[model samples]
Target: MINFINKFKGKSSMILRKSKPYRYLICILVFMTTYALLAMGLLPEKYSLEVAQVSPATIYAPRTVVDPYLTKLAEDEAVAAVPEVYNLEASITVAALSGLNQTYASLEEAAIEEDPQEQELLLQAIKENLSEEIEISHVRKFINLTSEQREYIYTNTYEILERNLSQGIKIESIDRAKNQVINELTLLTTDRDIRDLLIDINVPLVRANLLYSAEATERDRRQALNEVTEVKILKDTKIIDQGEVVTELHIRQLEALGLQETSSQDFGYYLGLALLIGIVFIIIGVYLNIYNQSILVDSHKLLLLGIIFCLTLLLSKAFSYFSAYLIPITLAPLLITILFDRNIALLLTIPLAIFSGIIVGNEFTYIILALTSGTVAVFSVRKVNQRSDLTRAGVIIAAANGLTLIALSLLTGSFQGATDFIKNISLDIIMGMVAALLSSILTIGILPFLESAFGVTTSIRLLELANPNNGALKRLLIETPGTYHHSIIVGNLAEAAAEEVGADPILARVGAYYHDIGKVSEPYYFIENQLGNENIHDSMKPLESSKIITNHAKEGVSIASKFGLPPVIIDLIQQHHGTTKIAYFYHKAKEQGEGEINESDFRYPGPKPQTKEAAIIMLADSVEAAVRSLKQPTKDKINDIISTIIEDKIQDGQLDQCDLTLADIKKIKEKFAKVLLGIFHQRIQYPQK
Candidate 1:
């Protein structure tokens, strides 16, 4: 496994270095394509309905979706419950009375005609004109009446029309009012023609009294449905029964939800999905540019984050086939938070949740649950100090996942009955706990592999190296006790000062511990291990001694690699003195009247400190050795020495590469002063008390 990882890592490194310029664009396009494809799978073809077609199979909600048509149907039913309105036409009755009087006058005129056929003809003409205004039967009766009788008939017909038209009547019930007018006229006069005339005139005159209020009815319906405050079809709810013949209503519900599978795919639908994916990719890219530029530019970090994202999404897609709650959504964040910082892990959380939701279905519930749970996972392990802390973090993460699941379930009101509520809640709680545990388990199992593959340093790996039983540290302790003790003091000073500067203290400390491992090869040649009068370096030429000192850094790198120590610690071994000249050896060589002494030959070959932790260790290593040489060092002396050491490093351009600020330098000096004081403080002698 280790060899395979090394080969894979080597290949990846070559490709990344070669393609550095277009790495960001490549990552974005790859992830965007993946997410778009996942969305395409979940999204249905543009919804369409075929009349009288049986559904191929039962269809369920791919995710929680609203049924707008169902909501509208409910609102329409509320509007239909309101009663119909009828409005009476007062003008109809007025016009009818005027026509009746005009008909009576014409009949009176006809009675005087001497020709009997002409008189009948004139009466018939009057009746025909009146028929347009009132009813045919009533006009005919008035036409034959004597002058005095016709007057009563006209007055009676006008009164009955007024009575019927005075009140509101539905358009459908206009005939009932006509019948009422007939009954009324019959009682007033014994003539059959009079009653029939009343029926024709009043019925024709009656208009719709109440009108249907279209606007008011719609407003009331909206108010009613707006108060309903619930989704028609919630998440995990079934849409249709298996083997049941599809109905028109079923197609309507499915079409409203955009879950209906049509015969052909929609171009517009895919276009919308591609556009949305582009937006999300833009969001991720912008965030990385603004807050995590290192990860944005470094191809290795980008690949690691992208790989984790794709892994989580693929798993979420697989688990969605079973149930939403079963997805181990928190795993990526946990792994990232442990291997990287909380900020980067938190940033990745949003995309992880979003892509997981897309792969599962278009469901926000999964996103919500994943984000909340992953936040807990990130924060819980933020300050991990021991191996047990990861497990403890797992338990807390599980509790948080379960609580978030319950809260979201309550808000959506997805429960149908007590049995359903209990069963589902239990399953959700169990699955949520499983997701958190799986995050811990997977992170624990996969962290070492990732660290080795990417050459990434995590606090867990640092803590392991800090142990006395560690291979490289143990070898130093047994082979060269003096170098081991020197390395331990360097580790303490580096860790304290790095903390003050807000750098990685564990990385600083762990790097310091392995920095002097090369001295194990020739322990007595160094003064720290030469506790007796004999000094191997005193008899040697200054040139040879300087060569021995410079060679230790190279030798340390060789030894460190042999022991399988991380690359970060080996960098400290090489960069601790940087390219600074060996001042003691150079002056001694000049005093001996040598032909020439080159400063570069005595300097350790170095790339200098490239990170804040490595830079802190370099300063701390010099300060520890110089402070220990002081004769009963006081707090004031320690402070001056630490400040002078920092100034010299600045003047020599040793601190140029690292990111430590002026403010950070002052804090590192103060920490060095405090730590040195503890080591060199005077212990007062006292008489036996």
Candidate 2:
């Protein structure tokens, strides 16, 4: 029963390891738990109110007036009548004055001439010249006079003229004074017209004042117009009597009518909203995992990176509560890139952005901010190599964030408020910079665990390992100096060849440095590690010698695993030897008539080179070793050796498994020939002894 239980547990573990659904469930659980805790109060419930006001439409009208041409004709006619009215008054005055003058003149003529008939006629004309009675109705309105007023003016005018005559004025003086007399008569008669004119002028002035007051009152009333409506509710309440003051309870009851109670369902709705947001974030995380190639290495690395990314998101939220200036959420992707690969960093950036949004409360502003920062972080540090590189990248991220914030502020017209604008802008820069720094810090902290568990050899780690003083490399140098020197040359050759074919030159170089590391186990058995000593292989049988040499490939893989080399480098170490036979030992055995010898025993273990770098390293290794065996090296000999090695590998089907095509092989052969020629170029012949 115990064994069965153990088997069941193993199967479950295997299933869990292979199951995508299980991982997805774990991711969802993590997201939900984090959202529930970190975003509890982060999300704010949004409420909207729409308001509209009712207003009266205004209308405008123009005042009407009589036709201009008709009014002009009426004014002209009235002006023409004024002259006639004045002429009539003048004619009457002239006639009355002429008669008075004639009476006086005739009396003087009768005393002087002794002509009785002339004298009598003159006297009769004077006596008969009575003042003509004029009809005044046509000029009455203009003159503003009543009939009694006109008569009184006429009497005064006559008396003034009689007074002038009584003062003994001469007849010539009377004729010249006729105009003065007429003017006096006209003034007396028109006094009532002037008084009535004053009344007419005063009436319009009074009416104008009243109209102005009415217009002003109408303007004020229009300004004061307002719509007021009252709503009443049915309720039972105590009321005060009409003569008594209202009690506080009455006022409280009125106030209670204005209060509203919110429904409990609102909170439930908000909770569901939060859940939906959390689910969206989880879905984003899963999609990012599937499609993002950078982070999609083996399952182990993905898991480690996912955990770190999620943790960073949660920690950023927790720290944000204390102060929003703490750990930047975008640093998660940057950190992944720093410790792992850029592809992974870019892939994880999406989920990390989603997590950042959730932590900051799922607002559109926060989501956009997080996404912008994360994208900037990933792009800015794509080529980061050192700790200080992250600092530079951090500054870049800060600048990008600042620019984005300033642009947004400008677009939203919120830049007028200096304090809030500067504060928000500063926060964006600080968060971006802090994210970069924190990413570097967290990357350094988590790198060892990830490297150990996933066997990732970052460039920084490789540089550290390349130092001659490193324990493993130093041991190889001191104990097997010849092998060490050979490995360095092979590394140089492999790096050049790998670069020519557009393969990973760093991996090729590093693999070359460690490719023959197992030769250190039996240092003297290999030719390069034998120093000046005798050949160990000469004393051993062909098959035994072949076995010893073939064993190094297996031993190198074991050592690589023990030392935690990545699977890619380990594959290179193993497949660098491929299934090629140990030709020297195997051919010697054939010539010696060795019967029934297993060919497989003489070959390196089976998996051929699967990548260009591994295949290049294998070819470089063979060409370098074969060129060293030539007695007198020449360009022709070096070229022949390189071509033979390539052709032999091709004919033996060792290159079949690798992706190198016939065209690629030809290119590789040319590159090898050129490099070999340069290495074996002729030097100046020394002077003979």
Candidate 3:
């Protein structure tokens, strides 16, 4: 048993060593728990219902489902309403014309024959070739007619066939069409024999041109069936009234909604829901892996993210029991934006809103409301300077929520009466406002704890530390006023440089404000705080002066720690000087004939600047002190000094640790030059002097 426990512990330790597997385990746990929570609320409730019995209680649909029987009935009605279609062949008319012309041409050929035997033979052939309705006697009479009379009969016959057959004839209209052709010929020709011959020739030629098309008819029926809208039973709609007798319709509806005792558990629904949530998780995971891999690889950040996701899901589920509109949908996004970045917050809001929608029975209006309000909350707190700013952000989120609810209400028009409509709108507004306010209130209460628990510093805390009233800054201001003033100039320079290089300006500025807190311990020992040019360092050995100067960085870390400054700010305080040699003391020691002076003894211990903000503060701190030391700090002199300081730092390899590119360095140079010029620019002498 001891060996088994040790083996399990060993395996657990191995799994935790690899961040990806650990992260995956956390994700799996979150996904399973999230699925369980959603299923608890969303799974259908089974009822023991029967026909002609009073319902024990009213039941609402857990999800939208189509009434298959009602939809089938509607589709059948739609198909029955569709008219049967027929197609005109058009070839039937052409065939009729061809047959009539052949008969007329044969008769004409026989009429042109002068030999009585040949003419009789031709008439016999034409009669045999004709339809059974056309007799040889009619053909012989047609052959016996004068050529002009024959031409007139042929023209009348052709006209009759063309007119009757061109109009589409259905199977029922064929006889009427034949009689009409016969009547037209009778009115056109007075001779009985000619009319009878033309009747026989044209009547048989008029076939039914319009034919029933089964394919077209079936296509129309299928279209009508497709057009039949399904009868959908909405979620949360009362399926049966309490104390009402259960009927066959109620039983069927219950079965359709999987609410009947006989209805088996819908594994497919559970599978579909799981797959949908899996897709949302995949989207968030893929985004983090692609654009923000550091978060995915960091155990603490990943744990925080998973916790936030699950917490939001649980809160949304719990709140949905009251009203979906009252869910604090902005909470996750607001926390994420403050803890991480805006891009992650925006992308993550999509899945969070989708989860909110699911918790509320998939209300799409709630999804829209959540996304709109969450996005507004993100932008509002993008740069939190104070705790009250969060309250202000809450007010903005409330306004966004109220506006979004009003727009959705207007679009859905779910109101039934004027008084109810007003009441519903007012309730929505109040709930939406409460939800927004609740998110803000929760964020404020939870922020400090999360910061302490996670060991992360937010912008709001940085801003607070930057306040002159803070213990560290206040001590530096009172004990080392000159250093305090110098630190302010460094902050201005650092902020401008940081902004130009796309680094966090607030962090750079705040870090600068506390970078020299150790100087407060020995205010008069520093040159800037000395009275006139009284040199305290002149009386001390060059090595001792260097030691005193280098000790401030270490002392600043201790001071900042005592003051409870963040690790990142402490890092800035420690790394501002990097490992660069203190040139003044080393040069002084060498010129004073101090034998074989070692340069390493005069250097400050450092881990270098590990981030762009740290690097900027270093440069800003150096440039501010160097430019202030120049007696004639003109524009040209300040520009030259700033460039020289940057170049020296670059050559000394102080910037090697940070990710500052050459382009960023150039922008920093320009910004430093511009700011220093503004500070050291000339002022006109007074006329009274």
Candidate 2 lDDT trough over 10 residues, lowest sum: 202-211
Best by lDDT: 3
Model 1 lDDT at residue 258: 67
lDDT string, candidate 1, 541-565, tens digits: 8999999988888889888877888
Regions of candidate 3 where Cα sits further than 4 Å from its true position: 1-18, 48-57, 62-64, 80-212, 234-238, 241-252, 261-265, 414-421, 467-489, 496-502, 517-563, 588-601, 627-643, 659-689
Q: TM per model? A: 0.72, 0.61, 0.75
Residue 110 displacement in candidate 3 (angstroms) = 10
Give residue 659's lDDT in candidate 1 (0 to 100).
92
Of the two candidates 2 and 3, the one with more favorable lDDT, higher being better, is 3
In candidate 1, stretches whose alpha carbon ends up further than 4 angstroms from where it belongs are 1-15, 21-33, 40-50, 53-269, 413-421, 683-689
TM-score of 1: 0.72
Candidate 1 lDDT score at position 688: 96
Query: How does candidate 2 fare on TM-score?
Result: 0.61
- Expressed as tens digits, the lDDT of each residue in 1-689 for candidate 2 is 97588579657765665667766666666566655555565423322211121112211111121223343444555444432111112333455456544533443444344465765564445334322222222222422344455445435644766544334333334444544444544554345543333222221111101012345454444443322112223332222233334334333322333211222434554576567656766565576567664433334545666577667766766776754434566667666776665666665566566656555544345555566777777777776545566677767766666676677667777656888778656776566556556655666666666676556666656666667887667777988898788878778888887777777777788888888877877788988877666898888899999988999888877776566567677788899989998988988888888787778888999589989988988998898889877888898888888888888988888888878877777777887777777777778999999
Choose the strongest candidate by TM-score.
Answer: 3
- Name the lDDT value of residue 574 in candidate 3: 95
